[model samples]
Structures are given as C-alpha cells and as structure tokens.
Target chain A: MRAAGKRFAGGRSHGDSRVDQFIEQIITGLSIGSILLLVAMGLSIIYGSMGIINLAHGEFVMLGAYTAWLLQSHFGLGLLASLVPIFIVVAAVGWIIERYVLSLLNNRPLDTILATWGVGIMLQQSVRLMVGSELRYVQMPPSLSDSTDVLGFSVSSYRVFLFFVAIALFAVTWLLMNRTTVGMKLRAIMQDRSVAASFGINAKRVYALTFAYGAGLAGLAGALVSPLKSVSPDMGTGYVVDAFMVVVLGGVQSLAGTVASAFFLGELSGAIAFLQNDTVAKAIVLLAIVVLIRFRPEGLFATRVRT
Target chain B: MSISRRTLMRNAAALGAFAGTGFPHIWIKNADLARAAAGEIKVGVLFSLTGTTAIIEESLNKATILAIEEINAAGGIKGSKIVPIVEDPASDPATFSEKARKLVVGDKCVSVFGSYTSASRKAVLPVFERQNNLYWYPTLYEGRECSKNVVYTGAVPNQQQDEFVPWLIKKFGKKFYLIGSNYIYPKEENNYCKKLLAKYGGEVVAEEYVPLGHSEFSSVINKIRSTQPNVIFSTVVGDSVVALHRQYRAAGLDPEKMPMASLTTSENEVAAMGGEAAAGHFTSAPYFQVHKSPENEKFVAAYRKRWGADKVTHFVSEACYFQTYLFKQAVEKLAASDITPPNIRDAVKGQETVAPQGRVRIEPENLHTWLWPKIAQAKSNGQFEILVEAKEWLKPLPYAAYPGQVCTEKGLVEKS
Candidate 1:
C-alpha cells in the first residue's frame, strides 16, 4: 500500500498527480484491452465453433509478426500496408493445418491440444532456424509516431488508433456473424452439426473457413502489435496465455462478454500494477479470476447450450 | 534474399567438399570430428541463442567463433587447433546448468565460455564447481559474488556504477528516477544506483519495477513525467528496452533535457530500437565499437569481413572476443598438454593481455578482469560516441562494498 501511494505522490500536487496517474492507467488498460480483444476474439470464435483448444493459436500470432517483418524488410512495405497480406498468408497456413491435420482429430479434444502444442513448438523452431533467432523490429507509421496532448497529459496517437482499430474489427466480425449466410451456417454448426448437415449446410467447409478466419484475426492482432513490442519467435507464448484468460473470463461463446472481460482484466491489472508491484498484481489478478471461475464455472456470461 | 544467399553458400561449400571424395555433408562433419579428436583442443561455447536474450547472445556466439578462427589461423595454441562445440541454452537457467554439465562431463571441454544474464551464470556455477571445470562468463553484470571456477571477463557493479553515477550527477541534476525489469540484475542494479546517488549528493525520486516482457510503459511514463526526475536510470532488458525507450520518446519527454541512462542498452538494442529513439541516451559500458583504437579497428574489420558488414558488435560480444584471447594466453602459460581445470585456473591468475578493449588483467584475488570504464552517448546512426573513458584500467572488485581499491589515469591498485 505504501509503495503504491509513494509512486502516485510525486513532485506535482498530490491530488492532481493521483488523478493523472489514474487517467494514464485507464489509457494503458484500454491499450492492453484492445490487444487482448483482437487476440481473444479469434480464440473465442475458434473454441466456440470447433471445440478445439488451439495451443498453437499464439504461434499464428508469431507467424503474422514474421510475415510483416519479411514484407517490410523485402519490399519496404509499411506496417499498415502489410496487414492484409499477413492475414492471407497466415490464414492459408491455418487452413491447411485445419483441413489435413486437425480434421483427423476433430472430436478428440485432448489430442488436439497436444497436437497444437507440438505444432506451436515446430513453428517456433522453424522460425528460429529460418530467420535466425533475433528480435526483429517493425517501425511504427510516421503519422502516428508522435503523441497528442490531451488535458495537459501526453497521450500516444498510436494507442488511440489501436482502440479504434479494435472497435472497427469487432464491429466487422459481429456483422459477419449476424448478417451473412456463412454466419448462419457457423451458428447452426456450432449448435448442432447433424442438424446443420440435415439443413444442407456444409459443416466441413464452414469449420475450415471459421478456423482460417480466426487465424486471420490472430494474424491481424500480431501485425497490429508488432510495432509496439519486439517481434520474436516466442512473442506469442505470453499473449496466448493472457488471451486465454480474456476469452475464458469473458464467457467463451459471448463476444460482448469477451470485450467486457478484456477491459476489466486490463484495467484491474493496470490499476493494481500502479499501486502494487507487477508480480503481485499478476498474482492478485489470477487469484481473483480463479475465485471468479469457482463461482461461475461457465464464465461471466456464457449461454446455456445443450451439447 | 539473405536466406537464398546463405543457401547458396551452403551449397557451394557442399559442392567443394563433394568434389574431393564425393562424400556427403554428414561424412564431412564426421571427418572434422575425427580431426578434432586427433589434434584439436575442445572448448565449449554456450550462450542463449534462441530465447529472449538471443539478440545479444547470438552476437557473443559469433565473437567467440571469430576469436577461435583467428587463434587457429595464427598457428593454433601450442600447435593444437581449438575445436569449439557450440550449444544453445535457449535462455533457460535449468537448461544452462544441464548444458554446462554436458560440456564438462560429457563433451570433455577444457573450458566453457558463455552466459549473458547473471541468472544463467548462477545456475551453471554450482555445476562448474562440482565438476572442477572453468566457465568464462563474458557479460557486464550486477556483481557481488565470485566463483573460483568461473573467470568473469566483464565489468562488475563497482566498475560500471562508479564511473556512471558521478558523471551523470554532474551532467544532469541530482534527482534520479530508477526503473528496471523485475529480475535479479535490475533489482541489484537499482540498489547500486540508490547507494551511488546517496554518495554523490543525489537522491532517487522514485523507484519502479515492471515484469520482464511487459511491453506497456504508459503508466510508468506517467510517473516519470510527474516525478520530473533529473535522470532516469533503466535496466530493463530485451523487448522491454525497446518499449520503454519508445514510450519515453512518445510521451514528449526530451532525451537531451532529462536523458535516460542504461547499463544494458548496447549497440544491438540501439539498432533494434532504431537510431532515432536511442539518440540522446547515455550508456555505461567498457567497450564500444566506435572506439578509435587499432585493436578495435582490426576487430571491427575482421568481424564485418566474417559476419557481413551489416551486423553490429556490442560490448558483451567484444568482451567475449577478449575472453577467448585471455583464455588462450592462460593456456599458453601452461606446459605440455595438461589442460586440467586446476592447471588452467592457476595459470589464468594475475594474467594480463592487451585486448581490443585496451588492456585486461585478471585479478588473482577475485578472478575478475580489470577493465577501463567508458561512458558513451548513442548517436542517430546506431553507434556510440565515447563521452568519457577511464585513463587507465580499473582494478576488479567483485564486491562493491570492498574499500581501499584506487584507480588513477596511469593504473589501478589495491591497498593491502
């Protein structure tokens, strides 16, 4: 408690400094939440439809980062321009894995976990062997490189852009799931595969497409994050753990729940970090989440679906 | 294009080998091993080549290999070529210990050179002690401990902070903001800074720690902004180094006005962060590639020639290069082919060498090298400009609490 108060009590007026630190923590929370939204959305979608726990989804993020690195290094493409290509490239790889390898272990949840874990290892090592294991850098866009002062506090424009990007991506995904034929088929298949097949919905095709789309979303997340963090082969491992928490705590099948959870976890962790040390903050967050899960085992807003 | 070029080089090497006896690459590897078994002395090269510290450790690996090549070309030590068996510890402490065991007990390496982080060094120390093997650690670290089985070729806490703190206090104001990644190195380093600040009539305004790989620095930046400290001393390593620097710049803080000082940011980090972000920051290190010495010039030329011109060298890598030469000098002092641990350790005591870092003499008392402390400023071109350098070698005091160690422009000596 003393450590927390000590940090906030600076050279500035005590109340003013505390207020500023709080506002800054909120912004940091939002920045973390946006990244979590992008990552966990894809993870939740895959888990909702396929019932497959993708341990390798984080590796997909690593792949997307590498794809962006290669494009920028080889063709002088900026971070924004490399996003679509990275999505396509990573989606195609995900599609191949789902069609040939994952299709074999569809109903076996335990096997899929081990298989994906193995795939993650393979992906990490392959990148290490090919790219030579060094931290690669992706330059931020020149336009968003500077900060914009808001109420006398300096705020990064890139972070503001990221928040907007997360909202836009979420809106697009929601529309795709609610207003389109693919969305209806995916929902039907998620609810009942046999019923969807009886209604002439191609469950197989939808499964592969949804998996690829999820992978693409992960790639997009990776591309967006590349400029902020150092891009390394093991970069995804940490994010995947955090994203899983976001998806689980948000209620795995509910997008709104995930969004809420992402913000909640981000803010809580950031605010706690502001007060306590980082390691203790992490412990408290995980402990709180664990207690939350004990009370609501299906998550905060999970729908009742009879399987 | 780089991958293809590497493939082409590999193919050409393969073709040249095949042209002689039509042997496969596997057989060629075996033949090299056979040669090593017959005449070469085996030395283990260990470094974190794949995980978080890979960026820095990979350069150290190349530096060690370059030294081996140079030594071999210079007609080998006592007519025996050195065979380096390289292994990647993958930046795990347990893996480091396991590999150290394998190198000593299994590979029969006479000496092992590696490790960047103090955690890894600590992990492998007991193994080296148990096996009666020598481990030459070549990274500047938060020092307080000395292992008889290990030879430290990098700057200790006193050697680094002694030069950095006073100069920083004089150049900047007296208030310091200390921040670091939550680990042994950073924790220890910040503690050292706290003590140094107190000694120099300076004070730490605030102290903060973030987890390793914690990319977000906005909260910490806000604190730094409000605290308005005169100097920001950072020991955040890996990706966090990039994040902190970027966020500090993005938060509208002028580097020239209230500059950041780091013990960890070398040329490797500066290049990764790009030159602009690191432009006005200060770094305390013993070696910089920009040093205009004949030894450094030759080292840079040979390294560029071997590893390509685009590749950059840093303090740790240069220290590793010097470590290998120092090892060779120690080995040369011994008679016959008795490369036993005790014999080598005894020979390395009080040994001196004119390395690329000027002059390094291993203190017999603590088994740590005496090095010249240098403070450099980062330039926009991803290089360092030496602001101040010690006039002479600073004697090794592994424990910072040790008093009566004195340094002058001419040399360093300790009072009995």
Candidate 2:
C-alpha cells in the first residue's frame, strides 16, 4: 500500500484565484470554439458554394483522425508528420464521395442530405468493421504535450497550438475564397451555376475542389483534436453536432460567422458550466441557440445581398 | 395437434442428426428435448457486438466464447456440447429486452448471459423473470436489488468502494472532488462514496457529471484545478474516460499530486488511454489483468492466445470468462437431460470457482458473487500494478446502502 504512493508528488495548487479561473475558462472555451470552427469551416464552405449539405463532413473528420492513427501506428509517423498525409488521404476520400456518390444526388437537396448521411453511416460502419469498435488514440506531438503557464494560469500548450491552427486555416480559407482564381469560379457558380458554366468556369470541377478543401480542413481539425480525445468510429457524431451548431448559428454560408458563433457558444457554455454544471450549461446554451434561431432564421451573420 | 408430413420429415432428420452424437436410444417425446440430451445444450450469449458499449462489451463476448470453447474442448458437461446462440443488443436497453425475449422464447436457450449497463440489465430483468429463465450478468454495477432469475458475477458498489475510499482518504486527504458520466451506476456509486466519505469525516470539495460519450473535459479540469482536491473520485465511464484522462494530463494536473481514484477505469479502459495518459491514476476493482496466481496466469495466457496478444482482459471480461465456467460447473451438477433453467439456477446458488481474480463464490443469500477487492496504480505499459487487496473475499451486500433493505436467499427483506 505504501509503495502505491511512490509516484505521489507533494501537492501544490495552481490557478486558485477567481481572476485566474475566469481567464483559464475563457481560454478553454476559445480552444473548444476553435475546434468547432475547424470542423465547421469546411461545412460552411461546402454549403456556401455548392449549396450541398454534405452530411458526411463529420465522417471526413473521423477518417482524418483514423488516417493519423493509422499512419502513426503502422508507419511510425509522428502526429506532425502525418498531418499532411491525413489531410490528403481524407480529402481524396471526400473527393471520391463527392464525384461518385453525391454528384448523382445534385439537383435533389433532400436526397443529397439523405445520401450524404447514408455515406456517413457507411463510412462509420466500414471503419467499425475494419478496425473494430475499440477506441484508438493518436500520439501527441512530444514538443507540445506539456502545459504552458499563461497569465499565472496553466493551459495546455496543445490546445493553444490548435487555436493557432484554426486561425491559420481560416486565413488560408479566406485567401482561397476571396483572392484565388478557384475562388472567383466558385463565387460565380454560387451566384449562378448556368452563367458560370456558360462563362467556361467548369463549375463541376470547381465544386469538387471546394468540397475537397472543406473536407481537408475538417480532417485537419480531427487530427489536431485526436491527441486530446480518443479516436473511435463514432467520435465524429459528438463533434459534428457542435460543428453544425456553429455553422447554423453562424450564417449558413459565412466562414467569419462560423468563427464568431463557435467561440460565442463555446464561451457561453464554458462560463455556464463553470458557474453551474455541464448539464445545465448544455441546456442553457442549446436554449439560447434555439431562441436566437427563431428571431433570425438566416442566422446571426447572414450575408446581406442586394437582390 | 396433428403433425404435417413436412414437419414430421424435418423432425426425423433432426432426430437422426441427434442419434449420430452416440447417445443411447432413449425414448424421447420431443425432438427438441432429445437435441438437448443427445446433441447440444443451447445457451444465449447476449452482448453489444455493435454500438457505444461495444468497446468493452466486445471483450466480454470474446471471453464468454473462449470459456465456452474451453468447456466444449473438455467434453462439454457430460458429452452434450454447449452451443451459444449469440445476439447483439447494440447497447440499447429496449433492444436488450427484445433480444432477451427472443433468445429465451424463440431460440429456446436454457440460460442467457448478457447486459453491461444497469439500464440494459433492468430492461432485460423483466423478460428473464417472466420466462423463469436464468440470466448471467457479468458487469460491476450499482447494487440496489436482488432478483431470483439472475446471477450476478461482478462486484457491487460496496465490494468496490468499501475498502477503496478509506485507503484513498488515508493515502491522500479528506477533500475529494467527485465526477462521473451522468448515469445510474455513477450516481449510485457516488451516493455510496458520499456516504462513506461522510462517515470517515472526509470533505467533498465539489461534485459534477458529464453526459455519456462527452469527450470535452477542459471545463471540468478547470474546476478540478481551482478546487485542488486531494483526490478526484471519478465514476466516468465509456470512451469519455480516455478523453478525461488525456485532457487531465494535457492540463498539467499531475495525477501523482491529485490522483484520480476511479471506480470505473479498468485495464481495458487503460488500454484505450495510453498508460502515460493515466500512469499515476488509481482504480479500485475486484480484478486486474496483472493479478498473480496460477489460475490468473493461465486465464490471461489463454485469453491472449485466443484473442490477440495485444487484447486485454479487464475486471468485467474476467468475470465474464469465469462465470461461464461457473455456469458449466452448475450445469454439470444436474443430468444433461434435466438441465432446465430452474435446475441450473438452483445448482449455481452456492458454486465456487477459481477465477482470474482469485477464489470467488456466489453468495446463496443474494445471488451476487463474493469477490476480492483491490486497488491498483496504472503503469505506463497499460498494465495495472496492484497496490492493496483484501485479505479474503468480501461478502456481497447489494442492499447495504439502504438500511431497511436486505436481499436474502428468498428475495428482498425489508424492515420498518
């Protein structure tokens, strides 16, 4: 019994102050919000340009996590080394899904939603059948495994890394959508597909690329978050719900809106959870989203368009 | 009732198949009954082969199969092979009861083994009771009731926390922060923990719950950090265990300083969260894979050989494996021809066996097993190092938390 206490370090408290607690909670919430943004950014992009609700977006994230786990576990690839490979692999999967399965359901919005959902379940079940339903873990990058002191409060350096990644992804996405030639073509298609097609934009190719990019972003989110959570076949569902919440609460087609709402909801839930508890926090946050949705059906940051 | 020619011919083929098993030509009225005596003894193996709980339950299913396979290889309880009719309840309570009904009524299994979650057990309870069939439940759970129709092979809260809490308080300090998945097992176990804590004059800094499958823990970790309790009494179950442990590590909260004393984390869970993720954390259970004994060594070796080298056997799977041997031992007492549910149930009442954990026996008084209690610190290799173990088997007390309630051989006995 005494031997059990061999590893027992003497106690020392950190971040006991109320101000410190507040600051820590804010950072924690931002970290969570950043994850939501990462997952939702691709969803918003796909929806904004294609008007295709890729319900399999979450599965893309799950696949990315699985890819990271696979690469690291089989090939001895570190988490950092596997990120590009994970993104590419998952994005390729997303590309095939879009070109082969989703493209057939194009004109039918309801069918596209249902088909993508079917694709999601198929992806989940295939993973379950192939890998088994056991929880899989991804190795954390050794460099960022420890906590860093911030404003006298300790915060996970990995989470801080994820936040920066989310910001960087958002910037890249912003540049791609606003400045790139692909962005011009995608915008033309979003505005009027026939006109874009008539203007030789090759609307279908552009749509597929946008879809693939969105999926790549979601996959990256999954890879980054994998170290913090267990990777399982159904891990995507928990994240997808929050991602949808972020996308819906943000204007459906707005990347900036997704970033704003993800943090807003995250901080709201985080602060509430600190004040009360998780159950109450979730209930209140969901209630707030519902009430907000009733007043503004187009969402908080609906893009103003002159018709 | 008149038998059609088609049914008669099918019965003839089945009878012929049974005859090939080398049994003497006994006058049997029903072909199905002869199938039990001469050919096979069918039992139900109900488990969640798919769904949320599959991560843990799948191993339990494998353990059950491994035990059954071993039994069959050793001539199978007086020459009749034990055939398992396995079904996946998919971790749903309604499906558990539904499949339990089908396994008992439709498949005509002599006895059934299943259920992990308390909700599924409760759901499955009524079907077994109504059918008067035996159900073997092999998962540690919150104890509050004793049913005549079921045999419990896992530890209850009393068997788990009775020794654990005091040891934690003595080793650490009085202040404990309680957290768990929002479910009955955790809630009930925490009730027992609180009761014990209060009796021991320990202080509860805070208590909280996360929803099932909830993976985020930064907020909860923040609370733990601010409170700075000597111990975190965690009952958090399922995949969320991995998340909580990983996040706890990432948050720079040293388990060595304020260790998570878990009632739910076992070797299988530790396997999911790498050893480093929860290295210094503690778990209180009736069994761990690293339990040393000839019986345990053989069981672990055989289990790994049958499954994979990397596959782990935890408290639940150990119970699941030994309980099958218990079932076989009970079934062997009665003649193969007379192996009915009631007979099996009666025979299983006082059965004792050497489990991977150690020597264990079912308490005839309550139908719950007498189990060894141990606290273990997780090693970085995903194996647990035993810290403290009870000198002898702890008695099962399903209704101990409730003063007026007690479970006897007959059933629940209440006092005003």
Q: Residue B317 deviation, candidate 2, in Å?
A: 0.4
* Top lDDT prediction, candidate number: 2
Off by over 4 Å in 2: A1-16, A304-307, B1-35
TM per prediction: 0.90, 0.93
lDDT (0-100) at residue B361 of candidate 2?
98
List of clashing residue pairs for candidate 2 = none
iRMSD for each candidate structure, in the order shown: 9.4, 11.6
Q: Per-candidate DockQ versus the true complex?
A: 0.26, 0.33
* Chain B fold agreement for model 2, TM-score: 0.91
Native-to-model Cα distance after best TM-score fit, residue A52 in candidate 1, in Å = 1.5
lDDT per residue (tens digit) for residues B81-103 in model 2: 99998999989898898788878
Worst 10 residues of 1 chain B by lDDT: B23-32
